[model samples]
Target chain A: MDHLVILPILLPMFAGALLLLSGRASEGFKRSLCLLATLLQLPLAIALMAQASGGLQVYAAGNWMPPFGIVLVVDHLAALLLLVTAVLAIAAVVYAVRGDDLLGANFHALFQFQLMGINGAFLTGDLFNLFVFFEILLIASYALLLHGTGSARIRSGLHYVLLNLFGSALFLIAIGTLYGVTGTLNLADLSQRVAQLPAPDAPLVGAAAMLLLVVFGLKAAVFPLYFWLPKAYAAATPPVAALFAIMTKVGIYSILRIYTQVFGDTAGPLADLANGWLWPAALLTLVLGTIGALAASTLNGLISYLLVVSVGTLLAGLALDSHDALVGSLYYLIHSTWVCGALFLFAGIISRCRGPRFVGRLVPGPALSRPTLLSGLFFLAAISVIGLPPLSGFVGKLLLLRAAETGVAAGWLYSLLLGSGLVSIIAFSRAGSTLFWRTDPAAAAGGPVDNVRLAAVLALLLCSPLLVVFAGPLLDYLTITVDQLLDPQEYARQVLSMQISTSGGGH
Target chain B: MELLYALTLGVLTMSGVYLLLRARTFPVVVGLTLISYAVNLFLFAMGRLHTGKPAVLGQVAEHADPLPQALVLTAIVIGFAMTAFALVLALRAQGELENDHVDGRGKR
Candidate 1:
């Protein structure tokens, strides 16, 4: 009932619409408006986290009842993600403004719209409404991806677009089937009702689940379905790619939400079917994504492949189904989003200096040597991403290992995860060695580093230690989040109770 | 009557899969559209179609399942939007790359 729950979505949407309407306004105004809107959202997101930490809150739109109306539900897990997403978004917008000199007035507008779509997707509880928000985000991404529309970008962006379109189509079909069988789109109500279906309806439900898996799998860049990710990511401008980093995680969040909350009990034949095949699929995804990362040479390509690896790790975590595994996966998810996003931004900075052809090679020499301070910061960030000790990345990996050990599938998955981590370390080291350590004679001729770009890099670099220090509380928060996820009846009751209270009062 | 719906599902699945497997982006787009149509129809079918009865409840008759129908309407709109975006992106790619390969990344 409170405004806090919906503002995270509404603020960006209103900002985006305003930016579009004021498209002819000065760039300063647009930038300030975007910054003000994003800055305003941070406090709102914090307030939501505080409210949700106590219990789940569901807001049914337009005063409509469930199983019929669209709902916006925020549990601890969703709230935590919303908070993380908001923080990353703020950093990204700042970086975009500082680093991307080529960005025009329309850039801010598209960026706002993209944020609106992302927040909307996370907040919505209705399946169809989820699709609506997804489209809003995807359309905005299409424009952002093709901002400059070079041949390479257009080629890669198209691949990203077509593949996602296929996924969206499948998503539609899945929603259709689920609706036909369950006769309801409300997630909270569906969670309770789907389990009560007759035996004959099992296949239909299974089909729907499988279709959904495919749709989300593509979005998450899962194995055999991740062919479009690496190049598309590599070709985009850094800020755009940084935003893209959040996109796949959003897909993962959806999968986790739907699989556990809406379809919690996989009993009887369908349960057996999901368990038998899904885990193996996860295994393949983990292995393939790791191999791809190891093989890639370019910085952008390397980070792109790592994204695939991270997706694999997440899938493996879900497949194992241990609380430890879930915690590890969640931890890894946060670490990867920040690390990968930072790296992409760094890659952009490097590319700006050495040109796009600078992959797997350093500048000819130390051209911008005045700010020894900036290089020091970049070094810390780079080491952190490579999972060196006393940083967030290392702690996340440690949790994953610990989680893997607690499960029966750990014997094999643990080894795979370990191997993947090693490969990732090596891949990152190789890229770092080429980009940061290598001293090319030609690079020395370039002028001093831009202060704005240096500041953005430093900001990200400073986050490394904070992650390590705060790991205890972060882990506790995730544990509570997982507990809420596992037992969603609490969520359902909260929503239903709220509805009864409001209806009684209104009448 | 339900058998007819099942047969249509088979046809839709076949065509959609066939189109999806094509190398060209346009065909894939077409295939996706067909699949979406089939999916919407199948979801509608799940409510168990009744002869001479609409979903609206009246004074004298039992209402068919309103939930699936309402859900289908939403799906249709989303499906159309997805298709439109995909088509525009595809056309843009074709213009930019001078090729129509659905997998636009150069050499995998």
Candidate 2:
């Protein structure tokens, strides 16, 4: 029970390593092992979530202790994200088994390695370790992005690679600057130290904080920094793109974690560090992303653009910084990830059914083999994404609108949110009518639908309504998570007051 | 001494940004490497500019902090791996597309 916190990180690490060493194994064997590892994470995440709600749970590496050795802190927020990631991993693995897993050597291995990095990033209590985990996941993603051989993919992959490499360079610079000023890499220690930064050193600390924001912003694909996302995501195969959906949220998670804990409203000299620019940029991001969606000629392009819209909305909530706004953001965050991932998978199905020449274009095509099922799934996902009533998205937007009503930017937020929803409505309606109504029934009838892939998409699509159904409990959990996030004094105390074995300190 | 370090960082960063704006892949890869070098050096300097003292405790009033060195070592290794991966990707793009331009064509 006490060791549950490390299992999320360690299980994937060991699984990934084992998969790497067993290169001669059959594909089926490797995949099942990956599935088992991912399945184990769901219950483990639940247990960690339960335990974390009691208090912060810290596991010091090598038993050396807090400020000196590495620590993994399982608070409610980390646990919630872990659970969400684990669910997505399961769906992606199941979908890949329908044949996308054969794209490259050891795809399962890299997937697990990616999970290891993501879970480590969420769980680690140290800043430098977060950088290491970012690189781990990123290198894995670079390889995954180019999983198949195509000129278009390699072209976009190059841009993605170079851009992220640049982001990483800035990340290192930020961490170095922060360490130089604070002399500690442990997050809990840094939180206390950052609040007490002397006047002479305050500017340096503020610079470090802002640079970190830029690095994370690049990851999250904020307004000016998001140019590399749409094309890169569109070029990847469907299952891989679905898995990549959660990757952006990692950036959002970090922003929420750092700002609320280390750079909160009470930050001594650097209070409201990035707020001046954040909401305005987020609003612009929302506008640009929706416009991009409307302008997108292909269905994948539209979905990717919608992803940008979701991030913009989430950031606006983050900018508000009110408890209600955060609650809405967390709820919206989960809903968007699930729905976005499902849309990517559905795009694959749509493209496969329509043939490669007319891949998910908003043009007339032959009717699908299972037109009803395909169209039904598409309608559900589209409705949810466009924030129509009775779906999780509507509930999420309602909460966010209510939260925004109390903010200074209420007028702007209301116009953009509603306006974006209207634009998506027109876009999705046009695409849907062209896709289902205009296609000739004879030409599109014979494409064989893979049941495994169908089941995987169905599972994630089902989660949208399930989210709405269980909104009451989920909001309860998110409220506690936000409360835990805002109240960092207790986190600092818990992390700092751990029993340390002073004699075994060998670094 | 600080001026020298800051100037070196600035020059490397400027050259990196310049190359990164190029339309070719190899130069961009080189630019990434140069930027990482600058970042690594900056991380090393975070421990402060210590000259002759051992990294461990010594008779001197202060020793070089070993943590940044460790951090920089990790960064170097990861950066090397990324560079190798990016180079392989560039070579493949060249082989398949018959071009080395970052976008594989004249325009994005």
Candidate 3:
């Protein structure tokens, strides 16, 4: 009955609709409204996260019962992700306001709509509703990706759109198969039904589950399915790309939700299905992503590849399917999303300070405006990203590697993670030296970037060290979250237990 | 009825895949549209393909599963929106780049 479960979604949805309708408003008006809305979201998200830590909170839409009406479930994992998303949402909005808003019309509205989709996707407890939210976010992203009109944006955006459309088709097919076999779309109901599935229907359900994996994998940008990511992401405008850093996490989130909650070891033959292939594929993704990062000539390309690396690392941990591994991945998930968001925005500012033509290339350039701040920020981000000690990235990597010490593919996990770290160190060092140390003294500085942009970038960058500072409490929280996640029957009981009371014996 | 539905679904999906693998945006769009149609039909069939049965409650001892119908309806609308957006993107790319190839290469 806690209404907070749906407020995050509703607040953004209404704000977006209002922004669209008030077409005559000044950009400043729209931007301020958006800023206020996103700022308000932080407190709400924190409260939700706090409440969910105690127990699961379910909100049935329109007071209808679960398994019949749509429900939004806020468990610990969803709550944690909602908080991470809100943080990035704030950063992206601030950046858009400072500069990127000029690129297109109704930027604030589309931004809010994007948040609504993301928040909805994170909070919804129904599979069909998840699909709806995916489309919502995708449509908004398609517009945002093309926010700044350019040949490169349009070209990459087309491929991005088409690839996702194909993925959506696959998603629908999966949902239909699941529904046919299980007769339910509510995630809790689906979990129960999957547990008791008839033997004859096992293959059908397995096929559906595999199909769902492919769809989520495409979104998460796992190994073969990730071809659409680098170009598409690199082509997006900075704020949009920053928001997209979390989009891949949504795929990871769904994989965690569906696999652990619905198809865990209790689902007969379907038990541990993803395990056979997930770890190998995740290692491949890590290798490929690191290689891409090392070979990338442009900083944007490098960061895009690094995003893939983070996904790989997180999925590798998830594939391990142990409490320690899931806990480590969860920590890494929070740390990586923030760092990636900060880095993307920082890369944008770096590019802006360099000439447009020289944006993000490793070649030497004139000293940028705000040389000290930009270089310092870049150094900190580089350290954090490369997993140097005394920063958040190191903590995440340490936990993951430590967790892997007790897993089956300990060698592969440790080697790939360490190797990826080394490659990133070299790649970042080279790019840093090229940008900061190798600068030409007499070459003219690019135009002065606004102070607001620097603040926006710093806001996200500062969170990395803050994570290191608060690692004690955060790790404790993640331990409980993972404990909750590993026990699916408890989750099912909490979700469905409400059904009996809420239904009031109506049936 | 089941065999007929299965055959139609197979044909649609096969052709959809054929167009999807093409080098041009137009064919890809058509392929996407066809695939979505197949998926919609497939979802509708998940309700078990009852003929002449009302989806309304209490209409008979047996009724069609209303949930998949609702799901299909929603999917169709979303699919339409996706197609429109994609076509516009393709048109814009074609006009801007002077190419309709999916890759947007000028000479390819």
Candidate 4:
């Protein structure tokens, strides 16, 4: 059993703890240390992804058997997400190091702790442990969201904190109910138990499943629960908002992971329980998110709504619940996380160039110092986000559109998916023109752009075309990932049958 | 006994929710704390309430389900920390924004 599985979680835990204690250290030292840890994570994630491509790998924490102790399970999905997170971390940390860290105390430490929580959430196999990791990540996020203090951040922080605390309470009730009914909290064990659940217990389990969906939906920014996201993400600093691109995906992952594993097709009466509810929510989320994008007055607000739109797209693909649709959803998930993250950094850059008076407000402002370079980057990002042909977003949407089944469902999927694409084109172009083309000629030219921050933006922005480059191999890997996901019994067999052969070492 | 326990949990949650929905920050924080208490109790009750049962196994025939107890402990710690954060955030918002309204707008 390779202990490499735990390194993703442990590396950041230790680094974050040390950084937190050494808050008195110089910024340069903290930057190097933070950069070193984030840089180390990329190769580690790739190695893990390679290892995961072979099959499902489970690491029993503390050498305890699966049903009794906490376990970290890495499959194609987990490994792929870990790599995405690592790449995004490099971008976010690089951006934060360029003066954003100085704007707040303990930024580096909070960042690492955030990564630890995210990585743990991605890898955990136990339901209770998932809640623990959720709190860990949420706690880190509350502080990070309030970084670079402003009245806007503080006010948004209050709502974000209060709402998530309520959500946390609900999450515990769901976990407690599931444990009460099934007598187990291990996801694999719960799946097995759910399959044999008595008729009476099924309703209780169903209720619990709904509560879990509500909590995850709030986190994922589903239609009704997504109200807090736009304000909060827009108010957040660039790097923090960039890292949060993966945060909503964390909710999407939980929805897919838990729903598929615990109450999937094999769970008999309770199988696919949440799909009925998720279907409408996914569609409404799409419509509302697109409208929000169109109405957004600020550049960051536009990007934030676009993030909600991505969530809607991904959730729709999941709600469609077919193999190909899932493939598209997963593909789109990666594209949106990276490109959307880069867009947040773009907001930051644009705000800087626009000067203090106009911060990417979709209005005529001072002419940019580097209009060609900045506009060129904006055009590339806008095109990619709008899902134009030959980019990663285009491919993901194509797969999704192709996957929609015939009849009312396909009609809705095609119209809405394509309609949103067209509307986004308009929204992005309007914002783009106002930002770059409609600048006031008389005003002073904006200051020279920061190269360090630009490099950070390039790191994530470049992945759009890079994903297109790797589309073939990536799709093939995702094909296996989706199929592996559809089969829950194989997962249960592997996890539940781990015998305690060596007492300490995993069997 | 079960009815009373259930009512107590319900009241805490209800009160917590009522306060949580208030416009002011202080009441909202208090409401969140109340909900946390309800959640803790509910989690503890999920293991099936028992009297005079030992938490440890092998000490007595009627050892309680230790898992919920353990889960409750974790939930309590998390809930406590979150409440403190919420209270401090409320205070800071009050100080920074010059009002305690959750939305930061003063009375119209």
Candidate 5:
């Protein structure tokens, strides 16, 4: 069990180091190592999920106890996210290894390091360690985002880096304030201590929460903080961009973790003062992100907007916060990651066949002479993203709306969610019409699709319907996970009691 | 001492925001650096200023909160890496595009 806790992070970190040290290694060798590492993670993540479902597991490093040492705790929620991350990572790695001529040995090394950071962020029980994991991931992403170094990529990558740096700064400030007040950085320890603080200290907590919210909001690409995302995402290569689809969700995951565990139900003086203020901000995010998606003209830009819609949905879910809504949010997150990643891969294939100039031009390409498997795949992924029935995405939205309707805030939030869903459907339809239906004369003259890229698109396309069929059991599992997260007393007790028992043995 | 540190933070943040809003890429890079420094100091200050207490086990007195210091150290290294990457990107953009506007689409 302890080995399961460490394997996800260690596997990637070790692979990354080996790849980096074996400088100038053959691209074939590096690709095999990357695939091997990612494939190995899939089973390990499954085992971690099974272990976490039984109860929370905590691993303290160097035999040091909590509050004095670093620990990695795996709750059900973390395990689910780790599993989703592994799936997306494996897909992205496979696609990169197969098609892209530019994806070299060093790229695989950076990819593995990025995985390490992401997994560590999800698994760690310490606040400082989370920050460390974030930095590791962000730095790796910075390099990967600029891997090809084109004019557009470089320009967008700079904005991406600067914006995240700002978010990182805010995160540091939040950590500082949290430490200043509580004198501890261990998350489980802080969760207990934060509940004990007096009324007068409420302002500090609110300030800290707001700061952290802003930081994560920026990362998550919520309204007012999301301007950099579309351009940055659009500028990167397809495989890199596909992996980045999961990056913003990491921010949402952090916010969910902190709010549920650390902040809990204690409104404090400041929360009461700011009563429901953040909800309006969240509403603005929902509307603004959807509108942005609606207006996007290019295939990549449109997908970027859809990513924004996913964030909007997650935020709306947070505002509603019922059990069903939380489950909806979790399900939506999983559905969106798969759909968005698949869409981007398909878009890459389309762009390759049509060339950059043909995109969004509404020009008809050559009619499909044979079985157009990629087009079918793109259509399925698009429908799933739009939350059409008989798809995994539909199940998530149905549950989300069901959950939202039962709340006191239902009157306004329900309408907003419904409106957002409609706009998303229309936006995705427009992208599909332009991409699959419209054809350009030049593209028509250009011959058949690249076999390898088309194959990658087909693989992802097959995944969407399968996800829809499995939604029932997956949702049940997620619901139980969310329930455990909502009441983490068992987790808190295990951590604290472990520390006490270990210290008793030492003395 | 706390007041001075707070003032430094205020100034850093203000300048960083101003530079961040600038149209050019170089100033934005500079602004990010200033902001990073302020953040590092801010995180370091969370341990509550005690001049004599090092973040190490000693024979005497109380120790500073080594956790925040450790966290800040990682932040600083990561910050440096990101900053260097940003600079390289800025250089690349200027080399390839013949312009230095932070946003690729030009002055908006």
Candidate 6:
């Protein structure tokens, strides 16, 4: 069981390599191979999740000890994200199998590589390794974003690639500076060294920390750095966009992990280095993202902006920096990732139904073929996104609001959060009415929708209801996760104290 | 020696930024390359300006740091791949739009 911790990373790599090498294979063969690998991740993630519930389980690569060799740490948060990634991979692959994969060669291969990168990023305990995994995921994304290239995708891809290249440069610079000052790239080791840092190194470390924030900010699609997101995501083929729903959260995850574990409250003078910038950034991101959603010209555009809004909300949850808030944010993180994915998938369907002439354009064209079922699903997803009751979004928001309880901070958070919800309601409503209500009764709806794609969309959207049903146990798990996260001392002790039990044949 | 190294990195980065801000794809690619070169140098420098020092420990009293060199190598490889990809994509964009403007707009 302990050995299986690295499977999440290895499985995808092997599958991806196989898919890539099987260049001459039939479409059916490729699709089944990709689907089978994706499905297998579910049980693997669940088993890891079960194992992680006990405590921090570390897997030292190549039988090396901590602070020396690379380690993969599995806590509840990492395992939970692994499960989310698996679920999303399945939904995305299922959708892509229908026809999108044919748009470009190596689609399955690229998809699996990206998953491997994402899984590695989640599990890796070394800072340098994190950067490597980030590059892997990013490079894969660069190709995937331009897959099924159109004028729109190519144009947008150009900007996306360049900006991210710059971002990557910043990331390397940051990692270098930290390694220079600390002499170690291991997270747990850094936690201890940072706590006892001599006074002179503070400024350099502080600068590096902020640089890291900027890099992650770009990835998370936070305000001011998020210009690339709407165009890139909206222009992508639906399955790629759906899979990308977790990409920004990877930034959020890094922020959560690094801030809590490596530079938590115990780090002498650097105690709250990031919180000050983070809090205001989160608020501004939320406000601007809401407005962007309201102003979107197309349904895909609207969904993309809604995603930006989710990033904002989740950031605010993190910025709140309280245990209860963290739990709420974690729950919201899961809910938003799944819901945004569902919305992106649905956006593809909506565009298809309206035909090439009205591909995702918000204005009405023709009535959809499956008007009732489609509209119902859209309504549920919209309500969930907008934080309406009997859905997961409301529960998430309620938990956050409860955490904010009565103060100047509380007031600000409440208004901003609730205000964003109102604006989202307006945005989704306008889109719904424009696309669904104002449809032309006489015009012909497009070709019959693919059943497999529709089923994939349904599966992702259904996570909203599923989230609500299981919210109680999920919140409890998150509470423990947060507690684990906040205790940097414990994490450091546990990780650094780990000894290599299986002695290799050596002197 | 340290001053010369620092100035070289600074100049490279300065030119990189300048070209990066240009509206054309070719210059942007050049700019990215130059900047990556600067970053690699900067990363290498983080290990300090050591001459004739062994990187391995327990041999010499004063040893150089080997970690930053490894990091720089990884960066260079990644930067190479990114540059190649960027060049291909730029070419594709140029052919598609028949212009080199980064945003696919009229020649600026």
The candidate maximizing lDDT is 4
lDDT of 5 by residue, A1-507 (tens): 256798899999999999898877777888899889988988988999999877888887666788777889988888998988888888788788875625433788889999999999899998878888988898888888877656777778778887888888888888889888888778888877777777777678779878888887788888788888988888777888888888899988987887777776543343222215446766787788788888886778888888887888776786666678889989889888878988887777777666555643334554433325656676678778878887877887788778877545776677886788798888877766665666554444433576666666666656677777887788889889888877745667887677533545442
Q: Cα RMSD (Å) between model 4 and the true structure?
A: 1.3
Task: List model 3 lDDT by residue over A1-507, tens digit each.
Answer: 567889999999999999999879888889999999988889999999889977989887887778888889988889999899999989989998986888888888999999999999999999999999999999999999999988988888998999999999999999999988888999988888888888899899999999999999999999988888888888888888999999999999999989888888777768887887788889999999999999988888889999999999999999988899999999999989999999999888888888776787888887877778778889999899878988999999999899877545998888889999999999999989898889877767776877887888899988999999999999999999988888788877887777544545445
Per-residue lDDT over A185-212 for candidate 1, one digit per residue giving the tens place of the 0 to 100 score: 6777766666666889878888988888
**Against the true structure, whose TM-score is highest?**
4
| DockQ values per model | 0.56, 0.90, 0.94, 0.93, 0.78, 0.88
A184-251 per-residue lDDT for model 6 (tens digits): 88999998899999999999998998999999999999988998999999999999999999999999
i-RMSD values for every candidate model: 2.3, 0.7, 0.5, 0.6, 1.4, 0.6
Ordered from best to worst TM-score, the candidate numbers read 4, 6, 3, 2, 5, 1
User: Once model 4 is optimally superposed onto the true structure by TM-score, how far is the C-alpha of residue A113 displaced, in angstroms?
Assistant: 0.5
* lDDT of model number 6: 0.91
Q: Local error of candidate 3 at B41, Å?
A: 0.2
CAPRI band of model 4?
high
Over 4 Å off, model 5: A101-105, A266-278, A359-371, A406-408, A442-444, A450-452, A499-507, B104-108
Q: lDDT of each prediction vs. the true structure?
A: 0.75, 0.89, 0.90, 0.92, 0.78, 0.91
- Candidate 1 or 2, higher DockQ? 2
The runs of at least 3 residues in candidate 3 whose Cα sits more than 4 Å from the true structure, single-residue gaps closed, are: A406-408, A440-443, A499-507, B106-108
Give lDDT: candidate 2, residue A151: 81
User: Which candidate gets the maximum DockQ versus the true structure?
Assistant: 3
User: What's the true lDDT of residue A436 in model 5?
Assistant: 62
lDDT of 4: 0.92
For model 2, the superposed segments whose C-alpha errors exceed 4 Å read A406-408, A440-446, A501-507, B58-61
